[model samples]
Target: MKKLSVFFALLFLAFVSLPAHAGEIPIGIYGTLTGTDTDVNGMSYGPKDYLTYVNERAGGVMGHKYVPILLDGKNSIPEEVKVFKRLVEVEKVVLVNGWSTGGTKALRDQINTLIKIPFQAQSLSSDVLDPQKYPFIFLLGPTYEDQVLIALNYAKQKGAKTFAFIHADIEYGRAPVRNALEQKIPEKLGLKVLADIEYAGGSPDLTPQLLRVKELNPDYVYIQDSAGNTVKILRDAAKVGVPAGKFFGNNYNFQHIIPGTLGKDAEGFKALQINADWGENIPMMKEIEEFGRKQKIEKKDAYYTKGWVQGKVIHELISRVLKKTGGKIPEIGQFRIMLKDEWVKLENFDTGGGTPALFYKDHQGHTQARIVEVKAGKFATISDWIKTR
Candidate 1:
């Protein structure tokens, strides 16, 4: 009788010790964590770390923590599709963050129609912003087209007459450059484009291209490439004596890691970025700093902060649902429904001041970017927020 009573008591205690929520809110994120274009580590890590901080510090979103299953796409589109399936069908995740232009564009139809899971991605392709076509896929920032417009507008203001365009021979590299050269500049902005050049990513020598750029001497050079490839371009341009001040970069190339890699060669380099720099003491960044210290993270950058903002948006939606339902976390379907019906209407949504206020009705979320210049081994915001759309 005493053994039976003790067993009952222990069972009751175990039941009480279990967490109040049924299970974690599973979210999926896939990015190019490794491979040649591995700058996404900071981008992917930021959101993961913010979710970790939420669970550890804020008691999670309504006491149900975000359980993220992250995978590395290795910058491959096919691999990314497989990872997406694994996250959705196999893992049954309700929300996801994707990477790469090819992967995001490839999965847009399925994610919107068949899967019906809410997705936000790192790719800034303008095609994905159509609400009628891709209702489930949200872009984390302005589109590549918008970035191009903003960069060109800035160039025009700075007395740039003609432009030299350089990009990798890939979809991501081609998309914005194509839009700018073929449509935006000639028709809309009335700017002159001198030379359009395509090079393979991570090319060892860009002397031929830099030599061409030097000959043209366009008022500015707009480069659409990753950090690794950007290093090659800038170094080769310096060697070829292309004026450093005449060079500008897209958002992916505006990373802090680039300046560190280029040292003195990176001086006067300008690039467009979607968010504030690392050391900016925004409200959310203060919290992130504390979280970083606890986790032994010595540095944080713009990409990391961008990821953190993505996680924050997901958390905010879940939080609203939980609040409305009296601490009851909604099911996956309900969560999707809530986002589609109500959550997206959120106006002036705070993305930690990393980017502009996100107004989701237009489906592009604050089509604004800041220009940053590398000065004294760090990136500094040189211009006020400029709307691109």
Candidate 2:
């Protein structure tokens, strides 16, 4: 009887040593689901839908389903901070996917130092790429500065000398423009800055700003704003006699639905294409389409693809770790270490045609951009995937 008791005690000890939450992986998502600057709603939805599909079809990563605690900050910094803290402390999520430049920056130190959870931000802010300062923060693609640099390079190739930089008076809009106008354009590309314009985001009228841009007669105009304001800017620019063909925008401006939404106003609008176009005959696109068909989701935009790609990365890393551990989820530190050590080694990661290739050695997944121009009511690839300095 004593020997039997000893054997049962050993078995209980082994069972207790196993992970408490073995069958469920808890992750967190923070984005602006309902806000004025909520153009990326579809983007957030893409990942959510993909993860749902994974849970439904493939039984999730290594037979463990993801329990995503999603929160909306409504594009407010204070609100984002509150939500982020709750996600880390209360929810006890091991990983989080965040959005908004302001919120990401605000939570950088806490998430990196205190919480120590691996985080991927949708913000392409250059500050987020500094692995030394933000060891926990990972970006999906090229920094916003790189996007601006690509724009400058394309404009230079097309013989555009003087340029007008227009962006919202927000951190997301200001950071890249500052990098371009104050540093990269002059130091590297040797381009002339004609005007630095700013306008209220989602403003009904940008005629005053476009008039100022027209006064300078800039050879090219670089805009950093959301899709809605982008259309407004283009329309007002046309009315103010700033040719739409001379305009260029950032990655956020290049949604697949813009042309159909803006009709002729979106003509000649060129922006950096970080991912493959939606209708492109790519394997990822086909997969997304089939997934959408089954889910009855009709609007799969660029933002959606972006979100899906982010989810894919998370799924890949977790699946890899689980496979290596014989279906055991690693501890939080182990998970973070594996992501930093093993996942960053991924070469030319398949981002479902959303990006060319993703390798996060220094935490910047993409370093190139493809320029796409609005022609005949649709985005047309105008240049190859050009490398950024």
Candidate 3:
């Protein structure tokens, strides 16, 4: 959407008609795609659907075909950084979107902050929302901390007293550990955390952690790791007889850490909170879903839904300002100002009808969340909705 930039500029300039631009405009989409495994990185097909839908019918935003340049970070940070720089400087792209939290963080840190280009993390994390840290980075979902806190409370209400924290001993693992522990008992709900143990991110065997957990026998288990190690933990958890308590897992990082290894064993495991499908009910979801179906594509994971939402929402904001700017972006600074203006107006806005939102202003502007669990080889919601975000 370079055309979107032109469109926003037009809006600022009080010109209604779209201005013509030469050649195809490049929009950066940085995420993992074309992998056998799904859900970790957004499906490339989903973007294809979104682009195709808008292009085929809407004629794309402001007459540009929405050419998304793929920079498959492949869940690698360095690669993500390299691609991000290439997208902004070499390619002269107006915006960037992609997969991988590590990649998002890498771009945020590596890029020149003063450049002030808007960035959104398709991954479901609030780390990027810190106004102090990555001011330009926008999150599209509730913080995992809020999600777990809601879960902790829910567990307490469901007679959960002791929680076992089984997480990969890494940054993602540590953040949740802090959130789960910092809270006091909420009124009548008796929630107590028993053990907070760390498992290797890719550990082949999780016997040590499982055995340690079994000795304590917690009332609930909250896992904060992904990849093959997560599967090993699930399998070994079953093998070691760690009491049939409520189990919470991370978003199946698509490494089959859960579905591949845990197989049916992960059924009913209440891990993270999210919506079921993007298209079955919601308008935005419908837009992407129908687009995918028409284009002969399928986007299984809600993460991709969130990513596409990021694109649409960001574009919507850009369109808002660009309408005023006479379809031309004066500089990166002005673009940042336009985003800040749009965000301030939507400070209280919530996408309540569908999908859990990325929110947090203090910690993050979290919108809402619903807890989902795996049932019979597919994910199912445990509660109708949990609005912790």
Candidate 4:
């Protein structure tokens, strides 16, 4: 009777030890879902929604369902770190999709040294581009430095002799501008730097800063900020006699909501287009649109396009790993290493017209972008895709 009782106890322990959903891949995703930076919440939802589409339509990859565990980082560095620990130590996610430049920078060393899970960052900050130091980190597009260079080149081509920068006072807003100035990128492009203006993000009024900009009256002003702040800058610039046509913004400022919100005030505003806009006649949009029909798309803009492309990349990499491991998911640690190894091997990979063919040899998936201007209150591609190497 004692031997039988011990055998039953062991069976119960084994049953409880099994995963709640066997063969489900847990990928951790955290972003500013409900916070000051909620304007870009689609960045978080894009991957989750794409993975859901895979689960519902195709039953996941290689019979292993992708279980995306999304959490709100609140765009705070401490919150992001807490979420990262939960995902890595408790949830045991194979990969993490992180948000914010500050959070990505804050967690870089920990991600490399201790956690060792693959990370996909939404930040395009050049500071985090060193693969030797942060081997597990990857970005969706060109570095912010690249975007600055592209914008400077565009300004020079349009015969602008002097430029200034108006950026929010944050890591995401200030780093790229500092890098550009330190590198003498504007000088190399034959444009003189007139002013480097920094302001608190989400400030209700930027007229004082715009008044300073009006005094300098730089030929062009490069805006480094989120959608909300960009709108504030534009409205104040117009009031301060700065033409909206003279302001250029990076990819983050390229959102339909901006033009839709400001209307004519947003006219003539230029931004970098790293991903094909939503509803474009591209191959990938067909899938996104089909998914939208079944469910309400949170944000119908380029950011969503970027998220969908990220999902596709994750799907392809996981599929490759599964095929190599004989259709079986390996142990968590080994699986993450394999994912990182497979990620770097991707080259000239098609993203269904989301961006130019992506090459991840340098850990930035794509480096090409085009200039889009707000014409008639809509973003229209103005130049051929410019390579930002």
Q: TM-scores across all candidates?
A: 0.91, 0.90, 0.78, 0.93
- Model 2, global lDDT: 0.79
After superposing candidate 4 on the true structure, give the runs of residues whose Cα lies further than 4 Å from its correct spot. Answer: 1-22
Model with the higher TM-score, candidate 3 or 4: 4
What does candidate 3 score in Cα RMSD to the true structure? 7.0
Candidate 3 residue spans exceeding 4 A from truth: 1-18, 22-25, 33-38, 43-49, 98-112, 123-126, 179-191, 226-229, 243-245, 250-264, 276-279, 293-299, 329-333, 347-353, 356-365, 375-378
Candidate 4 versus the native: TM-score?
Answer: 0.93
Best by lDDT: 4
User: Can you write out model 2's per-residue Cα lDDT over 263-362, one digit (the tens) per residue?
Assistant: 8877898988777656667777777776877786534577777887888888887877777788887776777666656556766787767787788788
lDDT of 1 at 118: 80
Worst lDDT run of 10 residues, candidate 2, spans 181-190
Per-residue lDDT tens digits of candidate 3, residues 224-335?
7554455677678788876323577654432323654576676666666454354347667666656665565444565556555555555566566666766565355566
Instruction: Identify the candidate with maximal TM-score.
Output: 4
RMSD to native for every prediction? Answer: 2.8, 4.8, 7.0, 5.5
lDDT at 180 for candidate 1?
65
